[model samples]
Target chain A: MTRPNLQVALDHSDLPSAIKDVTNVGDIVDIIEVGTILILQAGDQAVKCIRAMYPDKKIVADTKCADAGGTVAENVQKAGADWTTVICCATIPTMKAAAEKIEEVQVELYGDWTYEQAQLWLDAGISQVIYHQSRDALFAGETWGEKDLTKVQKLIDMGFRVSVTGGLDVETLKLFKGMPVYTFITGRGITAAENPAQAATDFLAEIKRIWGE
Target chain B: MTRPNLQVALDHSDLPSAIKDVTNVGDIVDIIEVGTILILQAGDQAVKCIRAMYPDKKIVADTKCADAGGTVAENVQKAGADWTTVICCATIPTMKAAAEKIEEVQVELYGDWTYEQAQLWLDAGISQVIYHQSRDALFAGETWGEKDLTKVQKLIDMGFRVSVTGGLDVETLKLFKGMPVYTFITGRGITAAENPAQAATDFLAEIKRIWGE
Candidate 1:
């Protein structure tokens, strides 16, 4: 199995703070996610600025698009995002439109979604999926457990490059000890840490320790 | 008994085009929507710029938020949007977070939503709901018909200040002749017209003809 990539989600509500977090840890991270909140606050400039700063880094614009898939995907592509996200709730047509416009589109698992939907997304030419534990769900004390793992495993088995996100920390890394997670996305796990660079290094170390370098 | 508001959707891919459309019909329209595509391309700067130009206009940032509701809502609010949208697929917790942070939150009806969900939105303190016929759906030949009207009527009966959108034209306005629509959101119907100002005027005139002044 290939080693999992480490993606840092820059979910800060401001561009300067997000940029600061990236400046501290950008070198260590494999992918930079200009998070939804940051995008909403700062606009596509968040993606443009980050893309300008890290020319070779894989940038994910976490737009969480629900409709106008082609337009949204095309816009982010123009802004320099390598990949963008669409909510699972969006229709197959939306997915098809997005997939047609961008390099790659990830289906963000949110609210009620099904494995059947994942199949359709693949059929629509999207191979990336992000299994998310939402912030509110996390705030309500939900944690990653067997059920989430089961779904992730199922998605992987179905040929998705499955990524995991939402309030992830180093300790949480141990949960997926032997699983072939495509990427482990961390936001506050690193950005909110006292030392973001050290936090990123620790996350990378954890990924290597669990999945083997 | 109130006349429905005429809200122009600035769904252009860039700020300049959207601004030009707004400039053409801004004074006559009751709401200026910084559309999802524009927001995706330009970011909150779209809202901020529109707000700067039309300081007194009620700007709607069509964020179509799927999660991190409070952050998205608050960010748009700070950017001078009077309203922001949350997708129906978002959890009640998400809607509550948005409603708590903003003056008002509108649930943008997309795929697989129910009156039960609308009640939950109301319970979460959201009163506005935008019934969307997605662009993809329109492309697939989905038209506004009886089923959609029934749902819109049901939502109105349930006490939501319902707004309708999706490929709205002058003739489509006649369909909601007797309904109490809170707003009629038009995009290309006006913006893409040869005379955007004339199209906006025609919409206003049609609203008066159907719903009465």
Candidate 2:
């Protein structure tokens, strides 16, 4: 089994702060996600700036695009994003347009999905899926429990490169053992930490321990 | 009944072209929408440029925010947008977070809904509603023959600022007469025209004739 990658989600309100944090921990992170908030806050320039700063690192623009897929895909590609995300709920025409553009750039779907939505996305030729673990439940004394592992396995079985996200921390990382995840994405866990580099190093250590990398 | 404002939606893929077009017809356009494509393409720089170029115009960032409303609102507001859009399908928390950001930033919802959704938005403190017409049907030899003005009237009666969009042209503009529309948002009808300024002027003239402004 391929080892899962670590993607630091830069979902901050400002580009300078996000860049500063990424600069501190870019060495440990495999993929850098310009999260939805970052994309909305700074637009494509955020992607461009990050791409310039880390010339070889993979940068994914978390657009969460629901409509006008071709336009969004083309724009992000021009901004130096290696991958752009579309919402699973987007219309078929929009998906088709996005897929066509994906020939030139990578397109991933970002949303929690039922079995049917996952099947539909596969049918639409989307290979990447972002599975969000709801923050509300996590913050309200709920644990990162069994439900996610099952969902992750199901999506992996369906031939998707699944990315897991939502309030991920050291405790929750243990729950993902033996899961065929493509990338593990965490936001506040790293950016909000007192020592971002150490936090990233901790996350990398945990991943290596889980996967024996 | 209030005269419908003429909103020119700049959905261009580049800032220079969008700025050029807006400057050409900025005097006649009531609301300048830095469309989703433009925002995603150029980032908040697009909003800042438009606001700087057209200081008196009401600049709207069509962020189409799906989640994390406060972050999206603050970023765009920092970019100098007068209003920001939230997807109608967004959770209540997202909407409330957007509303809490700034009094000047109006939240616009887009979706096909019964009157119940309008009431829900009103109760939720959303002041703007977007009504979408199908562009495919409009372009495929279909007319506004089976028009429904009652929905627009109903939304207006509920005290929402309603905007009508989707391939809006002179032929279709006639059907909206007597409907309580707050704004008519035109994209391709103006932006794709051979002479965009003239096209904007013609649209404004038709709107004046209909509303006797």
Candidate 3:
């Protein structure tokens, strides 16, 4: 069984706070996502600074590019992003342009998509899929509902790498213990904690306990 | 008989060039969109700098937000964006959160939609609709087809503040001249020219000639 990777989503609007959390918990994080707000707030420097600090972990730029595919992809890749996200809502051609630009830099593409657009993205050769449970749903005390899980299952069944995000916590993660989730992207659950390192360590330990390393 | 506003889409990856383009063409341009690449490369500081430099024109942060509505909206608004864009592909509640956040800051929402999602966006009260032409389609030498124009007509009939973009130039602006396009977003046609001011002037002149503004 493939153990799910643990990705830390750094979404701080400023650089110092984001760096502090990464410094605290970098060891346990298998991947780091420079979240949409951070990218919008700090620019490519957010990813570059994080990459310079933690070159070992994969850095994902959550630019959520809806247009200007070549420029957006190259900017993020040149800033040292190993992977970048292209929103599925952008046209198939736009998505393709983004994917091609990332390819030029030898970086991977993570298609942030809804279920209806799954087959189309898959057909376009998008490798990884991010199934985002809306933050509103998470804040409203929603669980990882059965329908969302079913989509995850379908994506996994379709032979795609899948990551799940949206206020993920250790308790909710345990529900998919044996599933092949490529990554569990947690932001507030880890970075917002009193001790970020300990929170990340706990999350990693829980993953290992269930998936047996 | 409302005249379509001329918008300079600043998509430079850095500040100086973007500022230069605006300085050259700011007179004819009614709105200035800090494009996605500029936002990703320079942060909200991009918008703030442009707003400070060109205070008269409307400033838009083309964030194309894929998630985390509150933070993205707040970040752009704080940076002085008069409007911000949200991708229609994000979940409905997520889109609403973005819309509400922008409204809270007294800024407007530019909902970037694919045709299929138009009615849903309108029903959800997304005020402005951007009919983006994929950059890829333009590169493929594709003209704006009837299908695309039909949606524009439909949205205009439905009373949406519709903006048409995708490599719009002086020639194409004539096609939609008599139509009530709320805005025409032009990037390279003006910004990439040897004389950006002249290019923009020509575009504005064409618009005025056709619409008799």
Candidate 2: TM-score, chain B only: 0.90
lDDT of 2 at B59: 83
Please give the CA lDDT of all the candidate structures.
Answer: 0.89, 0.76, 0.78
Candidate achieving the largest lDDT: 1
lDDT of 2 by residue, B40-126 (tens): 877788989998988888988988776677778888887888888876555556666777775543444332344665576677788
Off by over 4 Å in 3: A103-116, A140-142, B103-116
**TM, every model:** 0.96, 0.86, 0.93
Clashing pairs in 2: A43-B43
lDDT of each residue in A157-208, candidate 3, tens digit only: 9877888887688888877866898888999999999898999999998988
**Residue range with the least summed lDDT across 10 consecutive positions in model 2 chain B:** B104-113
Model 1, range B34-113, lDDT digits (tens) per residue?
A: 99888877778899999998999899999988888888898899989998998888887788888777888898887777
Among these predictions, the greatest TM-score belongs to 1
lDDT of candidate 3 at residue A159, scale 0 to 100: 70
* lDDT accuracy of residue A31 in candidate 3: 89
- How far residue A56's Cα lies from its native spot in candidate 3, in Å, is 2.0
After superposition, candidate 2 runs with Cα above 4 Å error: A103-115, A133-159, B104-120, B133-159
